[model samples]
Target: MSRIVSLTASVFAIGLFAGSAVAAGDTITIGIPVGLSGANSVVAPSVVQASELAVDEINAKGGILGKKVVLEVADDASGAAGAQKAYDLLIFKKKVDAIVAMETSAARNAGLPIVNRGKIPYIYTSFYEGRSCNPYMYINAWVPEQQVAPIVDYFNKQGAKTFFLIGSDYAFGRGMLAFTKEYIEKNGGKVVGDEYAPMDATDWTAVLAKVKAVNPDAIITSTAGGAPNVTLTKQLRAAGIKALYGNLAVDEGTARSMGADAEGIYIAGSYFTNIDTPANKSFLAAVEKKFGNDLKTPNELSVPQYEAILAYKAAVEKAGTTEAAKVVPALAEVSVEGPRGTIAMSKQRHAPLTMYLGQVKADGSVSIISSFKDVDPGEQCPKLK
Candidate 1:
């Protein structure tokens, strides 16, 4: 698959930056570092498409602060080494003004120091483990408090007393399960089993057998990224485990891809494609019009890519310049009404977003059953100001 997609006709090639002397005022460049291969490849295309949609829309409205926005994309290839290489190329080689990145914690951790040294604004657009804070970096996705606590509360109300935990063997998976266990125990529930598999592992026979042996009231899975998530869910259904299933990592696109196997699985996130609000409907229509039927359904993982670009544009317009020192503080003050409703960047450098709890219907779409408004990330970072 091609790592770069140029939305505008006048996009400059990544190699052009090596010799070309360009003025930043002519066009603002936003670099996108995404996993175009490996474990995360299943969802990377949607992230890129969503970002292009946002760029097109912003350009249609005369671009950001009178300058057209262009995307310079680099493939992360779904690993730390790949992420480092991509970030280095985007920051030093391409000289992009800002970046929107979607990858695992390992990749993000590897790339953050480079971004910090460059002092370019980076918007991380994935739901991740909490307490990640760095200068010039902003997070647009839900953290543990914004996503886990509400879902656990809802599950507790549904008579789920004992829970089983499963995840990929990594920081994101382990960290999320740790938070889930904390919330479950704090809410008067007990953990019956906890298990983890490698991110690329496809075999889940033993894990499903353990779930059957434990006989927990509900099962929470945090399998990393796309393929592993589908494998785990499908295997669980095949084994006919009767425990209520709550998926912390499955997005709407992944759920739809699962077809009938995704039915009845519960999930919580900041956005679902089926949300009926005017803002959400507009976003869906724009996406459908832009990408037509070729694109997969937008999900929590992909939609935030669109929102992050819009937020960056807002911050740039408010600051009246693309300089990181000015835009970083401006980002904390700007809010954009996106598919997920009005999202404001917090003083802590993460969005204070709404949380939606839903279950997958037989048709592989989400039906929103409950929502928590204005959920804060609850972790404080160094103030950008």
Candidate 2:
């Protein structure tokens, strides 16, 4: 962790020095408060790398308003309190121009006090249970309506009306199930069972045994690496729970880690490895070139971190200033040509997002089963008005 912070510090210091030495007139610091340690670190490195890549690409293209972009990353260590402290340090000490965050909605929610008080632009880069409308915060990933709503419709179409809800017992999980439950009931489906596991629990046999006993026609889970999606699948399969298993948690990296055990699982997200777009192809090739075959792009879950940086760059350029008031409006109008597609932010909602549903192939690869033909930010946050 220290090595990572040192590397980030060094790179950012270089950017700062380069800003002064080169024609670049200023330096804009973007703070990242994310799970940089613990189990969630599997995705943190990629998030940092993606943000760095965006900064590099922008700097190479003359940067934002002749100012070099610098990243200030602090370890959240997968805890809400730790994430809040990281955000405070980055804001009070580093004095960053904007903030980008990862998973752990609790962390983001906790940091809202600082962000609202400071009134600096903030972008969240995780597919989450969204309903926040902070003028200063632009959520740059899929929300419940975009990620989970369609899955309910899909399952209903398949005649899988009964469901069992499972997830980590946290803001992200609880919020997701809240929306999922509403959708299931609205769609005429019944939820036969529900369960919650701690964010870092390793044993889920008890939960799986209960799920098997309930034996719903389908199961939906919202979880992350701490309580990996595979652990549930493994225990469920062993428990002889043959119901259709689906999750919003199984991204390409998770699927790869789960190996054959992940096959036949259904997943709903905002991005997929099999997206046939020039943007995605080029992005994947670049990631492969940089990280080698061992690392996967982690689906659209990882794309928001990359896109948020680019969006920040574009906002700075469009606003012609780094002031939050100027940048916030510019951000709502900025459309990023992300790997998934063009992601446009809506002024009504402080979020820019899209949606994609895919099924894990027998080989652990994903096949896009359905997609919103055009990326939409969904219903804008009414409160933003």
Candidate 3:
């Protein structure tokens, strides 16, 4: 919105921009360290837009605590190295009061120490491997517990006895599949193929060949969100291997981008563009009015970003200050009704999400098969609260 304000090349050979109704230093700064490049680039625009809408709405309503909100966005590049660079500039240089990010787990890990060192509250808006603990951080997104069971259980019920697992060679990929494998077996299904590929690798020929070798009843993939999902799905379709397809990381936007390749790939998520609730309907209207044709479909990854921004505002109002020490504690105690529902991150630094099991239709829209309400995040950082 406002052209994303170009980032200076010196910031990582890229310029940085800030959008605030109030003057620079006079507003509440929310640093969004997201994947503007690399694999997550495809979905980053939606997250940024979500943040913009929340900030704009808050400002329109007289701003937060009488100060407008500003966003300082940096490209994490969807990895540790880029995240380290992004975090350094946003925290140490920009001196942002808080961070609300929807980035890969690797990026989150790379940036958390910097966020903590900067003494700022961090709202990790990514659905991830789970159990990532930090005194200054609260997760307003789904974990493996809320995500895994839906797809796996549906396949099991449909008589899928054997499953194949594949993912990117990273913490998120490995961790998600690991949890999925455990859950599959626990539910009386067998994992036939388990493998991984490098996140940046586009060629899945070898991986596909391996997958073909097993010819399992179900093939589940957990790749890096944006590009990997595109490449792997396309390759899977090209390979002509017919098996029950499921993807743990494909969002509504990414799936749509994949076009026909994403068809029939089952997935589970916390938000869909069609969730019928007054709050979600209003949010959708606002998003449409703001973006129109340019709107990147808001899905699970982005919906939380919008809601988390509101939650952050509530935390600040409750804490009486923007200081991380005070605000961090209030983060989990506040609730925001948005794209999903009443989302409160009170369950051990994580939120209990209402999950949906769906399959990608020919139009790239997900058809909800079953819905699980208030699914527990399950044992994530019990020692925190």
In candidate 2, what are the lDDT values of residues 162-199, reduced to their tens digit? 99999888888888898899889988999988889887
Who wins the lDDT comparison?
3
Candidate 3 clashing pairs?
7-14, 7-15, 7-16, 8-14, 8-15, 8-16, 9-13, 9-14
Candidate 3 structure quality by residue, lDDT tens digits, 1-385: 1122222233322113444334765788888999989989888888888988898899899878888787888889999999999999999988888889999999999998897788789999888888899998999988999999888888887789999998999999999999999999988999988989988879999988998988899999999889999999999999998999989998998888888998999999999887888888899889878866667788889999999999999999999888777898999779998889999999999999899999899988888888999999999998887
Error of 3 at 311 (Å): 0.5
TM-score of 1: 0.92
lDDT of 1 by residue, 1-385 (tens): 1122213222323312422454656788889888877678778778877878888888889988888788887888777899999999999988899988878887898999999878899999999987788888889898888888767887888899999999999889999999999989988999999999988899999989999998998999997788888899899999999888899998988788788999999999999987889998988888887666465678888888998999999999999989998998888889888999987777488888889999999988899998888887886575444
Q: What lDDT does candidate 1 reach at residue 361?
A: 98
Model 1 local distance difference test score: 0.84
Estimate the TM-score of every prediction.
Answer: 0.92, 0.89, 0.95
Clashes of 3: 8
Best by TM-score: 3
